[model samples]
Target: MSATRSAPVFAINHMVTPALRPQAFFQLARSLGLQDVEIRNDLAGNAIVDGTPAADIRAQAAETGVKIATINALQRFNEWTPEREKEAIELADYARDAGAAALVLVPVNDGTGRQDGERQNNLRKALTALLPVLNERGLKGFVEPLGFEICSLRSKREAVEAIEAIGGQDTFRIVHDTFHHHLAGEPELFPQWTGLVHISGVTDVAVSIGDMRDSHRVLVNAQDRLGNIAQIRKLLAEGYTGLFSFEPFAEEVHQLENPAAALSQSIVLIKSQLQA
Candidate 1:
């Protein structure tokens, strides 16, 4: 596909540099001329998981001139329960105090609760329950539909429908992940409702799409099998004006001796392709 549009802005996810401190990660983003980033709750010895105060996170972002686009996720969010509600409230409060604009809502991916009507009902229930918490904190809920076969929410269409059912159009938006979009086999871009776009590539030619896992995710390049460029171009052309956060989960990315340099190369590759 020939894309004549200007390159989209890129953001760095903490997954791309899990070993770095939040301060260091923010600096790396700034060094790359990027102003946005996504912090995660899963990284051990990291900010959120390490008990770092929200004020400190806010201070760090201010010091480095970086915006905390979101707190990477609240897991298994589709299963509505008192425990999940508590977690959502706490995470939302933390995100607001930490100056993050949103929280990512990830669904259960363990193969349970995925029955057709059951999944939609659970999604709507969760969104209904979480709406007030997010609204009170003035934050957006970025619902990210995981593409795994076992994932409770695999299709963006289902996610969007659930969001609409809950009347959450104002407080929620979907995450259009290139990797997940390919795996879900969904054709619609839904750019109007996409608040964020995650860009990752799968370059392993031998791995079947059904067998692809997070360990196989890598940065976009010539070897990308997920059509990151085409998806990005389509989203951009169709009115998705949001950050494309890099979320490579492969150990190779984490083990890089110079992650900033490696990430810069990937950014260059993506930009070249988008502006081609």
Candidate 2:
């Protein structure tokens, strides 16, 4: 957008259209002129959960020429246990076999395991256990801290500290989601440690910040109240060269008759703002 800087690269997330199949999702990414995408395992009847083979997903990526950025996510990852370990192994193996470069690790968000010293220890424990699994598969773990009040992990600083304490500086990185970043009211930016950026905007004037949820997350536009453009500018200025994947969770966006056109407009608006 600047005379000296190129525009940030944008990627599509499967959440944009959970109705589409994996192959169609890849096709959608290619149609958007994006080669990178974040796929989800939570979608009903989808991969990883529905038993879709990793080889099939890899073939889809190759055919559509879309790079699988990550599998979103291994839920409650910080509450490490034997069950979590098993799930982690399966997901990490799926990520590796699917040609994805990273796995998203979402911490417990159910208002439990968040005590002062307890949360840090739990975080370190999970990281310590996951380091080897990720290392074995040669995959990066993108630790995403949710911004909800009930979330066990709400601070990127804490996640970073845990990562450093466990000596996982290289094995793990953070996901700087614009929505979560704003919700958490975090002012710090770790551009160097960021591996992915999820972008979504909440424009409803009636909803208070505390009341905002994933259902309110919509595509970024001029009416966005999330300061998405400002966040992007800062990240870019600070040398964050990761993909900005659209991750709108609003049902309105998912129901759009032409999401590709809507996403294209959003991209244009973001680019124009950066240029300005």
- Please report the candidate that would top lDDT against the real structure: 2
Q: Model 2: runs farther than 4 Å from truth?
A: 1-5
Q: Which pairs clash (backbone N, Cα, C closer than 3 Å) in model 2?
A: none
Report the number of clashing residue pairs per model: 0, 0
Candidate 1 versus the native: TM-score? 0.97
lDDT of candidate 1 over 196-275, digit per residue (tens): 99989999999999999999999888999999989998888887788999999999989999988998999999888877
Give one digit per residue, the lDDT tens place, for model 2 in 1-276. Answer: 323235899999899999899999899888989999999989987765789999999998999899999999999999999999999999999999999999999989889998999999999999999999999999999999999999999999999999999999999999999999999998998888889999999999999999999999999999999999999999989888889999999999999999999999999999999999
Clashing pairs in 1: none
Name the 10 consecutive residues with the lowest summed lDDT in model 2: 1-10
